[model samples]
Target: MQKINKINQYLLENYPSIWNTRLVWMLLLGIAIHIIFFFIGFVSHGSPSTLQHTRAIDDYFSTGLVFVHIIISVLLIVGWLIFMFKNNAFKNFYPGSRNKLFLEFLQYFIIVFVSTTFYFSYMTGFRLFINYKYDDETMAKNVDIINRSVPFLSQNIEDYTLENRLSPKPFVDFYCETDINKIDKTKKYFVYHDRVYQYFRLYPKTVKQTDERGQFIYPEEEKKNKTALAYFENNNDDKSRTYYFKQQVEDLSQYIKTAAPSYYNYSAVFYDNANNPSTDIRKYRYENDINNLNNKEIYKQKQIVINRETIRILEKKSSKELEKLMEDFLAVSRDFDIANNLNARDWSAMVYHPDTFEVRSFIKLYQTKPNEIYDPNKAPEGRYGDYTKTVVVDSAAVSSDNYLNENGEIMQDTISARDFNPNLDREVSPKDYFKNNISGFYYYTSDLETFLGNVDTIKTDDFFWDAVHLYIWIAFALSVFIFSFRVTDLRSLLFSVISAGVIILAVTLFCVAVAFTFGFKGTFFILYTILVVGLLILLMPFITAGRFPKVVSSVFMIISMMAFPLFIWLIFGIVNEHQVAGCRSQVYVSDTYLNCRGVLDDFGLKISYAMIMFTFVFLYLYTGFIRKWKALPE
Candidate 1:
């Protein structure tokens, strides 16, 4: 108790204003209150959930708690203001110069403002906690899932297996055909042959064919045909002739029939024995058969028979290969399904939704029937009348039966039936239906865009800190305005406030009129003009030599409390605009051209600094002048 008294006595002797205002006690209490609010906010925070009712309850609790905290802060500040006003050290003739008085004012202002807005810091901390505890883990899990699934899903299976003898294209074609018609289309030899031919055509590989001398027939020599050369040179000149010639050449090659591995030897043998019919009877038979294969329909039937035989041989050889490819596809599909299910669950939890009851009430309010008893359980229906109408385009003429005069001549109707509406006669618009029926959760889904928005907001960046700092300055400005009454007499305060209000109203009206007459630039010019005029008024006391000017300047000083920082900001804006214009004019290749937001991005810090510097400088001079003016005789 003795030590406490000694400490209190020491504080009283050294810092009378601090002791009288009970500033320390109030600040400690404020800190305690903020800590309590932080815990409350942390405790009340809800995790993402699937149940709509649970989310709704959490939202209400969190929102209501914030509101209550804000109200309590307001009350606490009000009480602190009352307590501080009870003892006026400045009015009591306490030992203080201009600097001391300004410092005292600053101390009071900082304490009050900080106490009021410290909640912002606590909230930011809570967001940081959430980001660390939950969001990071979820993001890592999502990234892992994406990494595991995307590579396989993005691959083209056909490209991967193009070199394999038993390609997966046949199986895919078979699957698609079965899916569409509930039958294995591959069973048909023509279908299977067509698929195989298409697969080889799409993924063309070099095949070496030998001449009778056993020398390989190079593709370069085959492509040197004069007719093919002529077609290549002038293909665009005749589209139909080019297409016909291309198909004729392809048919002559019998590419599908000869390209099959099983029939390659047979084709070579047939080619070799084309002119040796007398040497071998079987060769003579084949030669006769080829010479007789002149009819197009007979050739097609022979091709079909060849395809049937080729398919039977290939199927027997590659059934196991086909099964392996199918298994691979199914494995990839299963992984994709797993990833998709995880994404859906995460998305459902991350999306924002309003309270279900609130949404229901809003719908009920807007969709109620005009003359019927309100029934919550009944579904709302739109009123209807003759609402459906169709417009006829490029009509020849109106029928005489529809529009005719009494003498039977056709007459135009001045008032069209389409223009007449005697009742509520429109179907409900799509927008209204969507608004009344759409769930908030479905409407605001957790897509990439919404996820990015949430991340941007919650991330602890310069933007978040800047916003918090800006609020603190705003609170400080309010404190200064409130404390201005403590520094001046009641009559002066009242006169200054009323005169400032009138001047503000007049200036606002004039600026609005200028904006209407010209545009935003004109309003901007008017505001700058007012800023210059106010600056001149602020400088008048220092430059001029009279009590009247000083007194008038002092009155204007109270009104200009908030304007000091605004003046600096406006000047900064002008300089930034000039810089942006200069950059735009230049042809420099740089990021400045792409992003020309400003000269400096830390606007909040700059403004806060301006507020502090201008407040100290202005208040220091003003306090001295007011003190001297009060001493002078009227």
Candidate 2:
């Protein structure tokens, strides 16, 4: 004990400034701890430079790992700085010793500036490299995966082309009324089926092709349209006859549905009477039978088929084989519909019930339903109205301030029209707005512009507010430094700034971890809720301490430092989540989300909290230092 006392006395006399035994020991301990943890981190998790190659998504595990790494590194740096200051390592070389406060400020400012620049540069560079890694082999693998995933992706175009190519021609012969002849051939009308040939084929060619008076004749012949054949082959005939009929019904339903849906129902045309028939001809067998029987008249012709090959194809084909063929055709049709941007509901209907997709019925529905094929971007004039023009076309005719309606009248106070810029909207054409303004490919140019704009706006706004916030932090630090050190020296100010920053960062990190870990769950949620409410409790005593003003002020300062970031987090966390969700959903490209997600995730709760805390400390110290500004003698 006597020896220790002697040593302390000697130290106090010989090294009055840097001879505090307790601080010296603490400095050694701090150094040891920092080294140990840093080494462990390097061994367990590869260096930050190496970890740059790791892929991360907007999820907890990856983000948490990164956060822990950054937080630990910051803590170590701050701890070492604190140890150096406490041990008076810079006492002789300190900037304030030469009374050069500008040099001190300039040095710290460069440190902050360089650190911020390097961090952002490193992160953005890594992100760019990762995004561009999709080379030819990777692209080929992706294509193959997509093809395998969706069976129809490869066959849509092929099937659509084949169906269209084989579709039967429209009816070339139709029976109609004429002033000159009782029965006249009309080329304009279409008979849904090939009944003309069906009826004629039954009679041998040796029989007179034309009956007396040059009038074509068929008394008893089977009517055969694709629809009738389809029905008879499935319901009315034996397997042998069914197969023969099945070959006749070519899978032209897709084509006929589009070509002439209203007229393509039945194939045969029947006169009211077989002889001395009236001008009226009926396409339905039931209607012809009823009309002829009611009027006691027989029609001139019963049924006919023109195409022989239509029936020959199914001659020996089994029902199962026909079913398989139909399945293949349906698959292609369905695929084509999707490829051509067909309505999902319509395509589903065609696939589910091909039999219901009759000519007349489909035509009526198709004509009445809205056409989904049209593109607003490439619409002809007078099609999509002026709204499409603002979104799709680039023109000064409708400036941001003055939006012209179709009638040439200015639309007053229209928010969308007033703020409409091609840069913000994803639909803007490459040739119009993107090519000149953006550097990257045309596809992502508009989205990149919007995302970058969002980032710029956020950063500028943050800086504007942060400038004031920074003043508060620096002012508080300055007050604390002067009080603690009993001196208004630049060295003290620097120590104070660094000390305050470490505390704020440490507290902010703890709060962020609490929030992130709890994820607003039951007990953790309650803890935060109490902390948020207790802010008022922490403030009330300071506000009401009228008798002991100095004590109250000191207590208030401490409480405010701890609670300020939490307050900001609660308010802005909610706001930022809303902002991110809105912006993310609106962006057409994913990179915007990728770029912004790290900053905005957890509602930017962590980032904003940390930023506010740091800014508050800087602003608090700086504000006080400025009022008592003085240039000490060199």
Specify the highest-TM-score model's number: 1
In order of appearance, the predictions have TM-scores of 0.48, 0.25
Model 1 TM-score on a 0 to 1 scale: 0.48
Residue ranges of candidate 1 with Cα displaced over 4 Å: 1-9, 50-64, 88-90, 135-142, 146-464, 505-528, 543-546, 549-551, 577-634
Point out the worst 10-residue segment of candidate 2 by lDDT: 194-203
Can you write out model 2's per-residue Cα lDDT over 196-234, one digit (the tens) per residue?
A: 111100111111243343332321233333211111111
Candidate 1 lDDT over 93-135, as tens digits, reads: 5334776666666767766665666456456555655566446
- Estimate every model's Cα lDDT from 0 to 1: 0.41, 0.33
Stretches of model 2 off by over 4 angstroms after superposition: 1-75, 86-126, 135-149, 152-552, 558-622, 625-634
Please give the clash total of every predicted structure, in order. Answer: 0, 44
Candidate 2's displacement at residue 334, Å, is: 29
